[model samples]
Target chain A: MIRICIFMMILLATYSCNDVLDVPSQSDEDIVLELWNHIDRNYCFFELKGINWDSIKTASLARLNVSTSESDLFEICGDMVLALEDGHAFLRNGQTNIVYDFKEGYDVHFDPIIVEKKYLNSSFQREGIYTYGMINDSIGYVYLYGFQNRELFENIKGYFKQRNPQKLIIDVRNNGGGDSALSLEIVEYLIDEETKVGYISVKNGEERDDFTEVANVVATLSSNNYPVKTNILINRGSYSASSYLAGMVKYIDNINVIGQITGGGGGGGQSFELPNGWVVRIPHHYFLDAKMNHIELGVEPDVEIENTELDIMNQRDLMLEMAIEY
Target chain B: MIKFDLDTYRLRFSLTPIKHGVTGLMLMISASVFSQSNKTMFFKAGFVQQSTFENRLTSNYRGGVGLNLELGFEKTSEKYVSRFSLDYSKANQGKSYISYSTIYKVDLKYENLKRIHTIKGLYIGGYIDVGTMINEKNGLWGSTNNPISFTQWASLGMVAQYSVKFKNDYLWNMSLSTPIVSYIIRPSYGSVWPDKFLEPQNFNLYERGIVTAGLKSGNVALFNNFSNTIIKTSMYFPFKNSQWHYGLEYSFNRIHTNEIKPLKQFANTISISFKRL
Candidate 1:
């Protein structure tokens, strides 16, 4: 009887719809200040990327006044997000979604028309999330759009056991990135030891540079030994976890990094809620190679190459041709 | 789908999520442990009107209507009574159309009250309650801005009740409860989660900051960072001259927490039940 009474009573109490809480509205200036102050205290790349955060805040706060509307505030906030320059930064207010990207005014260094016709025309096959085949009978090739799929590496392990090639070319162009552990998953299949690839840290204070002690990002060896010479193909489009991959494999003695420096996004995307119920995304975690060299600007390649439009017209992919020969 | 087995006293649920399926299986197994006792089982449903405000997300209070479901068992003796119950409720409420929040809570509790008065039916004792409440706002951004507020709390509280019996055999009861201490597990202010275990390169920043953060529980004073107060009124009388009692019950609770940011919620609920005598 007591338990039934308790349940019925609780059910009875739930039907009262009372408009009791009174919350005041925030002004446009307050919203701008909220965005600016949050990023100023928490954003991790002000010093590393040489951003003038104070000046950006001043410019944004200057745009708001007595007559500034919500749309105007949205634009102002969007501009500030763009000024952060990292692809992980974003702003959303239930209506508009905004993000910062770094794919302007630079050579893409890749062309689908050239690769499909020249390399994968007859070998148009996909296993799991991977597209792989032979560039020829002697060399193996696998091109990934991102590290969003870990099965790609798992499939690579199986592919190597079956048709073990003398060389393998890994392409990560325009791979915007995903979990960094997927990068280590690929490295584990290639390396022979528990090697430290990079360092990982998170911000712990309001200071721009305040962070936790860096933990060693290590990749251990797998049991099956497929001792193929590895070449990682990169470009300005390879970013974030892919850049992290390039940074790690470059330390391996047998691997050669071939192409332009990867488009850098070395931070993990983190978010917080604003007073107006909007979400603000920013880079909060930092990554560095084992030697304490910064990876935010990108991982330098051993063989820097770019695809020329003229070369594309001549049906020559010098990078792919180079991977086939190296 | 939910299937009940009366002979073995168990419930089986085929849920794709797998996690929920495991939890349901565990709940049934627990029910089977106490199946030998002579007890009255009750299932009840009612409506809930709630108003809540969380400064971590916003400053405004949002109100919404929702349905409540509760199931439990009770055993009564001349000296004392015990109750074990679980409840799940969900509601959609917000200030703006796009500012909506999907809030759901599954609460489990066990309490025992001992009769303190010899002449009158008055009880005084304690209860322990544990609940996890998750408030998700604006599903527009998938998994990112969801579960905007989360709190897992275990409370030790005191309960008091008084009853009056009329000559005609109808009984009226009133009770009040207040938490004496609470242990809370909540996310810190800055970061929530991307992927909890798979991310080797990420850690929550506030874990190393001023306040200590972990999965462990801490002993907090009554009303320090958390408080929940409940009041209830109920009536029981003869039902159609049979060996059953008809009852009407009303319950109210106010839950408040300011550990990281202020979140205050109030619920008023009512239901009717039949008790086997």
Candidate 2:
């Protein structure tokens, strides 16, 4: 009885919704369906994805081998995730940042240069997030510590546009996450308007790829027709729209994502109070890159640099140096 | 104790950051910034007698001291009680068979009840501690010639305790104490073999300074002799003004060595401490 109570308490502590209390009643399929309904209603862009989710879910679930392990369920769930074909769409557990980069047959591999980064700061310290600094005089650096306001976007774009530096290094090494629209708004100056950044697809167990879309970078700069030379510095820690911004920029080719690759795809986190009142964030949506490639493998880095104790001792900004030299 | 004694002597002094408007300050003259009100601080000094059930034959009795600090916060209202505290303790036992341990604990506790002896006095609280231990002088006999080794290790644990206060004043205070349950993991002795030996590292600026001064003063002998034990000895030093709080307290402790199934035995000790709380 004590163990059961402990288990229930833990389950309650971990689950974020009233429906989560009914998790025991629902099979894996029912849970997936429930998540799909929740995301379809709440995702920032559900209807725009434009895919038939039910058929996609049917196709994806049909591929499952009916295994009774957590991994098998994850694999089945992962296979279901691919139906969206939008690189930004994915499902992930918190265990490992490295997921099967679905583009490569969803093969298990190390988190891409991008996806391993989620560790810059476990709790992204909410200090001065929009603080701007200059590195090597050539790179205009604006560290988006937290993505809170449009003013941060305005600060970066305005700084870059006014200075018109030859190369701009937007340091997103520490950005945990924020608004995707805010990120997409910043991408406007870097990419041409007609350029299709990538697609975002959502899937349920039976409703596979219910939503799909080809989102265009709506940043005011390029939408207003100003393409600036940009290089966004990403560490393993960047996530959410920040990771999306990196992948979207990677597809455009004009923007070189420097530094180590990111800890690829992150699930769209939903905040909910567990039955025990412990606030939790559960990731519900998985994202991919423009080529229907899942970045859960993380976006690859143009240059790979490791942070070592020796580097800190010597006071080296290896990423900035690599970007400047490149 | 694996302390980080910095090279400089630094003192931290904090002043209230909250500002009161002129009208607010004038309206409440008694609640001035420098209210001589009681911001309660409790320092517990006690000792324990520890025995090893597994290694009784080889180990001897141990007597060591423990100190804990409790810092109170401004009450939000008369109905609610909240406080944040940093708890630390150090204990040492035996002459050649010393065990030293230290813990840095931070916890936010809330009192569910205000009145004493009532059912509402049933309080629940929890605290988390990250600490380190060092042990010297192992084996059944107090022989320095044994193939003993000193260990430096860290541990993490949580504590839940319940108590009802009889007298809540700084002096003449009394309370019945009982721990709900506290879980601690002491890493297996001799786990790190030849390649990975334990060495002490500075944990903070103050400890770094102490270490540097000790080293400069040629006090390597102090550490070299008592290097093998797992408990922290610095916390057990019988000094009344050892920490920030002024209090009087007492405790009992028991510690023992880890050995083979038969040879090792237990070490026990008891201590009584009186200080400003």
Candidate 3:
């Protein structure tokens, strides 16, 4: 009995000795290292962009010191992540917000005023996230400003049913992306058969290349198959889900993309908090076009056309005009 | 008969060897007939205070004050003892995140009792325990409302217990169980939310119901990537001719895995029990 009791005591003592809760207290340097390591492991565009993440870490660390305030540290961290050149990567502190400087730097190729007055014959109707009308009594025009409102797709389908125009123009030039699902919902109305839209791969492990097997993202054609000649207008300001839409439309037969290259952000964002309570949003999945091309560098237009200052001065949207002519 | 002194004869008759043998025989017979093998049924209710930490849900360990209720039955024979119990607990944790969890558990145990030397009221035993636990947790944000976040474990383990009977049939028992094999079910990482099953396009009336939703989340697993340990101690004081007992109990359990996060739970309770034999 004494021997058995002693053995049981030893077994209990040794059972979970290694299971210690060791959440380390973070110093400023430790926070930087953690942030760097987080990006090194989880960020999806590192390989595609050919960025040396280690050099970014070293450069950021050189700028840090004991006298650096919390906000300064936040900025340094944000700058380190912005080096990835992905618009989906972002960080925010109390007074500072960091995002890829895409909008202010790119030239404005789309003017809503010109599009409203000249293209739609000064008759623009707004329904949810969609602005639609008939251009010259021949082309159906729908300008999607965002992808959040799903009901707009159904409404556009109804409008197309009523008009039955020979050509359709979809102006998504400055449509900063929202939901990818809603983008597919819009594509379903135009496609006539099951289409392999693209592929999506996610991080399955902590390693950089520890990605899951790529899965084909298919968009099934909806019952409303309005097979008019479709022209999608894209520009350097078209981003995220809008860029994804550009990639999808390239596979459909009746669609032709016009204008400048899209501003690409082809991954989904996931948010994580730092030790000091600031949030960092990183892209964790890679979206590939049907040709297995990484769309992180933006999709090119089928017939590249740039809007000039003269075109804007004359109240002409050249891209919309091209779509109308096509 | 022979001319003997009356006092001496009386002493001899009182001290006879045969008379003492007959008395010893009768006591042995009565003891053999009325053995201490019986069955007992008990119901218990108590206030419980619990603390839990689940890293998948939150980073901090949260404490809650709640109620614990239990019903149990035990059968004891000369060689072994069998026990079955049903227990339920509900608690709310945290103030900001505000997590709430309810757990229902059922356990059946069989122990082979062994007598100990040098301790008159003590017994040492090895037990086989089979139990199932279902726990649901939800909070203010994230995937709390999703059914996939709920946890269910079907466990089989070996237990070691030391039980002591004190004066007037009072009892003290301490047990420790480490699950050698467990089947665990949890949500997959970055998958569709469980509410997708409740949507109109994919809805089934039976599966979308509240009760069935909780049950369907349980997936079978066998000794792969999951482990747990449970320790419980209790004291019972008999009253009213040993027909009723009052108990105080404390239990601690920790479960962890590489796939999901680790969870630790502690419960302290005081209960009233009734025993039927």
Candidate 4:
């Protein structure tokens, strides 16, 4: 019996020692299929956007042949991914870049030159990643164009604590989101109590609805005391974490969001690389408001005001003016 | 009392030599006379090297070097033996990721001391082990920002061991174990960032407890989704007939799984141990 056991152990050991280096051979079609399957399994917005992924795959496969160039394959893959209509989705190779088309026919509503000359009288104070000053020496105006830096919020908070302005305006027009944590940190300075902001869930399986249980996301008050009343300026360009911030601010007190509806991007982006060294990014997590409503469509402002071409031509930010009036 | 109890004294003296000779014969028949029933404690520390590949994160398998430490205790009797050990290891895979793991294992076995006709001091045993492994991997590439994959598994396996002792008090041991079942905790297809997952209300005991999500309902699998194989060998030499013994040990462990990602890991370690009987 002992000899039999020893012999079996040796046999098992010999079988296990076989190295399992099973790297899949990637042909052009194989790479396309890999990309499709990755997105099919991981992308968060498939069902929400009513995408027919199988049809898309079939169409894409029909475009690929033995003689298709890599550039052409990249384009076909890019076009197939763009069908998801998510701004966070993109495909990039060495020389080509494909991104969701966010530009619409709306005229540019924000011009810094005009705002600086007409609104702040050329006295806009520039801090780290933030430009701040008083509009009419009353309303504190802080313009944050991006959410990349966490320290910028601290500087803005310190500047506001000293001034003790009764009203403040946070302009996030054209602010493309960077890091959601930084956006949440900025939200911390705007509230004084535990605020149930929203819920977040991630794709748990390959099925479209295979999501984990919704996890409640909350914002706690910061150490610094900010202004009692706040106005957030947003436009169609506010996206991703910027849209997430807009959703959170609606739950806070004494804060009025005023502007055009934000350009919605409520999904968190995750990146995967294709076999040919190109990279593809897709949204893999969903962010919803406290009411369980998906925020993929841009969040509506408390007071929806559209800036006209006339307003820009006159060097007047109508939204900022509305925030000051509020 | 002056009338000596001659029968009792004569019987005691006569039985003493007979008892001594019987004990000598028994000792001669025993294969390993030095392996008396005793409890022992051991401490081991060593260098570890690991190679890992996860298809969800990257295509290339990466290698890392790190350290491992273990503490163990074993009890031996004529009928059975039992041992318990705790091991911790940490390794870094280039700039992409780092992994840390801890395992606590208990093994119970029945010893078979019957020797082959020509070979001496040979002992064979079959053991069943129950253990838990907690592993965490943190790095970039999986998500937008920093990503972390945390997994915990309750494991059970069977092992077969062969041990031999030489007349010079040197002992050699070899064992192989394969997992029978494991309850594994793997993140869903898309994992939330750690900062969000650690939120007060978002974090719950269920996420860290046995009732958490897994590959199947009730989260138990019999070598279907997750499998592990381990092999170890050691040699021990006593120091001048003292209770203390020093030994060198080498181990190889591999785990393969098909979950959110197809992940395969191989770890090799060599260590020196000190055991006290």
Candidate 5:
């Protein structure tokens, strides 16, 4: 027994993990090929968007050589990521992020200078990324630039107690988006029961059409309720979780979404490491709005209020003005 | 908040001696602590090492090593023996020891063996073990609500054991176990925000649901697979009325999955246990 015990102890004491695996190659071909292959199998959209990923991959490889510079390769990879037309598509390169933008033709209407000087002046109180104040005395206004707000609902509650406004305006014009859960927390407060918001699913297999079973997206009852009618203002820059918020709350009666068509980024994305160490973020989960309409590109406003260049030049945000007027 | 920086995301201790000395000190302390103590609680400290290839995250395999701690017990009788264990481990994985990514895991297990026959000092029996392994990686962030990469599994496996006795006073036990069938839960492909986060109340065909897996998973074009095997042996030394138990355990897990990544992991640990009369 003593001999067996000693042997096992000796074995355990001597055991050590060796660094055995060969280092991965960082050649240009290897980098591009890895990105192409990984995206080919893992990227969720192709069939949905009718994109020829193979053709893009072929073209991208042709542009590269064994001696392609890091900057040129980055641009090439960036171009490939943009081919999906997904605004959520982002290639993280160090501190400078290579992100996709679909808001080129669509103009940004929210004039921060005008809103600050004209509407908020010195009355706005800030919480997280949301900036808020009363615009028409009886009407409350909240400008949400991002959903990184943890105290969003709390900020609004304070505003309610202080102003006692009958209606609230939620301006999400250039709000790029953040945690969707934060958006849901506020939306759930406006509804009564557990509501079916939409259907959500994602790509499941290597095939472009391969998808997981669809799940009915439901919003449960909120523990606390917000007082007053709500109006959400959006524009071409409203995307991802912002669009998701609009799509979700469109089912509520008391809440109104008023603005131009939003920048549609209606799926969830995940990140992967490129052979060159750049991080690529892509979305696979796509959502179907309450009426089963695809909101992947953007969400249509319940009431379209186009904020023209003329409006901005005249120091007026028509979208915000419309919400305040309503 | 989780930050996925391209360069590195590692939490290193400020004190070098503490960080470097922890492994050896923990091994010695845990060995002595457990030995002085069957139907008994025990503690174990060891190294957990892994080589992982999750095509969803990267094309190349990543290697890592870190500390592992386990708390478990063994109860034995002439006709039967029962064992239970729970363990936690954390590791940072990347090439050349670069702490680019982190993985956290928790494991739970239970086993019961009934002796069918005994020849010489060798007793043979089949044991039943039901357990689960939950592993989460938080090294890189890809997208908001990427509900897809979550991986956890509840499995049932078959066990085989060998018992040895010397001079009718000392006891030695060895066992091998494999997870043959499992009801695995993972986020459906491409979904952001794992089901565990989004639909905690619902576990259906879609969202957070059970996907059946057998000996092997996945197919030709691109795939990651899992095969879980565990080997354990323990020796008991009696002192007066109380008993001391020394043990060695090694697990070879070929993390077969269709979730996000496929990992090859090996855990080596030694433990001492104390039991009452």
Candidate 6:
């Protein structure tokens, strides 16, 4: 009986049934493939390009093999994307919003005219590239680039009051843009009090005095009447805020703008971040002159002063020379 | 003293020698005879080394314990033959390895030759077996706390064996048998990944549900499935007595499925047993 029991137990142990299920692991090749799949599925404009996905696969493998770390792989991906040749499709880290100019010269092109005045507590630095003759023997030739800086404008005004210059040359060349609020204030000292500056029509898709900001400047200028002769110079780079200065002066009977057609562009743009962690800057609002036209194409200069290679070789600035002659 | 009952005379005596000596002697004599019986009870234990190459850069090795139990019963009247067997093994290497398996076999056989209740001769028989496979591994991702584990679909197979019994006596018995053919369902083996993220092409098929589905569909294609099974023709040689028996078997197995490269090998197994007949 005991023997039979042992045998039965062994038989039972041997005959029992069991079942097991399992899941599998993924390989490195699969990871690379998945990355590409995600890009193809989500990237904008994927269908438009004649991209060889198979070659991309081989290239990605070769790239990954050489990557020493995760960041290296990311950089390789960036390089591959850049190879796609779409200027707008570039990749960059989503950090700092600041854009830098690595070129040798200053972003704005101009020289400074420093003058001392008694009414003003500080000295004045008037920036411009055109030269107008000296007012007093002490106050030398002067060229005004921008009127935006309040302290700088006040001191310069004090100097003008003291010296009473014969002519003022304002150069807007290389003046990309800045605040237009100070233009009217500077114009008050330069023009007759009642003179009307040209009107501005800010085509910002709204209806209100289009040039409300410039009107504010004109209002201040109309209140303060100081008579002075001024000359403004314009160029290809004279745009936006700088054009506003040139336009305000040229509207008056005495002030004159001398140069070629401005690149009429007065649109306000906004920067935004894209889904792929890239930053894009696009024009959000448009600007117009008193004539209700876009400033983006630029405010055309009243007097066309075309500079040529011979002019540069002769070390002659025809625009400034013309302004002086006018 | 003797008591007479009917036409028979009965003699009763206290023959319990040494208080238990005669029973012990009888037991000793019977044990020897039983050890040589045609019907045998078998016990075997060994280590099985299983190697699988994925055809990738790496190959896996698993070493585990294997045990077998075989019971062969043959009665003279009709050469009534039957075999019951149990086999278990488990092996692993590194982070991956095969899981434990428990196999049970029960075979009922009929012999061609017949004799009185005490004797039997040649017989041909077939058997059916049901088996199960379990796989255990660590979870792809998550706390090491939650290890991954699962079981495979139950497997079933049929096998045929041919045997011949020579002599039956107080001293010993002798026999020989061979297993002809077998048909079986094999379990698929694989690993677990954190996500579908990095799996090889068709790797997901090794997963539990897919593997089961594939088996149901008669076998998955090479790209999608992997498994293990031994199909072979074998020869068995046995020497037995009334109380004990010894046997040896040699088989040429061809592994045509469940591998990157099909393999063929000749393997042998030896068994020892004791029985009562």
DockQ each:
0.13, 0.01, 0.02, 0.10, 0.18, 0.01
Backbone clash pairs in model 1 (N, Cα, C under 3 Å; residues 3+ apart or in different chains), count: 12
Instruction: Kindly report the docking quality category of candidate 3.
Output: incorrect
lDDT of 3 by residue, A1-326 (tens): 55676366436534633365444345778788878877876787878889999899899999988799887788889888789888877776545668886565667667877887776855658877788988867788888887665666777778778877888888898888876666666666678887777776766556788776666666665677776788999998898888988987886789888988898888766544455545566776767887888887888999988888888898888888777776
Query: Could you give the CAPRI-style class of model 5?
Result: incorrect
| TM-score (all chains, Cα) for each model | 0.76, 0.34, 0.64, 0.70, 0.76, 0.32
Q: Which stretches of model 3 miss by more than 4 angstroms?
A: A1-20, A103-105, A121-127, A136-138, A162-166, A224-227, A308-314, B1-224, B228-253, B260-277
Between prediction 5 and prediction 6, the one with superior DockQ is: 5
For candidate 2, give the DockQ.
0.01
Recovered share of real interface contacts in candidate 5: 0.31
Q: In order, what are the TM-scores of chain A for the candidates?
A: 0.87, 0.57, 0.90, 0.92, 0.88, 0.52
lDDT of 2 by residue, B1-277 (tens): 2222111111111112211232343344324332223343333334433332222111222333333333333332233333443323333343233222221222233333233223333322223222222233332221111112222212121121233333343333222212222222221121111110112122122223433432332211121121111112111222344332233433222122122111111222232322222
Top lDDT: which candidate number? 1
Going through the candidates in the order shown, the clash numbers are 12, 94, 0, 0, 23, 42
Give the winner by lDDT: 1 or 3: 1
lDDT of 5 at A238: 90
State which candidate, 2 or 3, has the greater DockQ. 3
- State candidate 3's DockQ: 0.02
Model 5 chain A: ten consecutive residues of lowest lDDT: A10-19
Higher-lDDT candidate among 3 and 6?
A: 3
Q: Model 4's chain B TM-score? A: 0.66
Q: Name every residue pair that clashes in candidate 4.
A: none
- Chain B TM-scores of the candidates: 0.76, 0.36, 0.62, 0.66, 0.62, 0.39
Q: For residues A42-66, could you state the per-residue lDDT of candidate 5 as single tens digits? A: 7766776899988998899999976
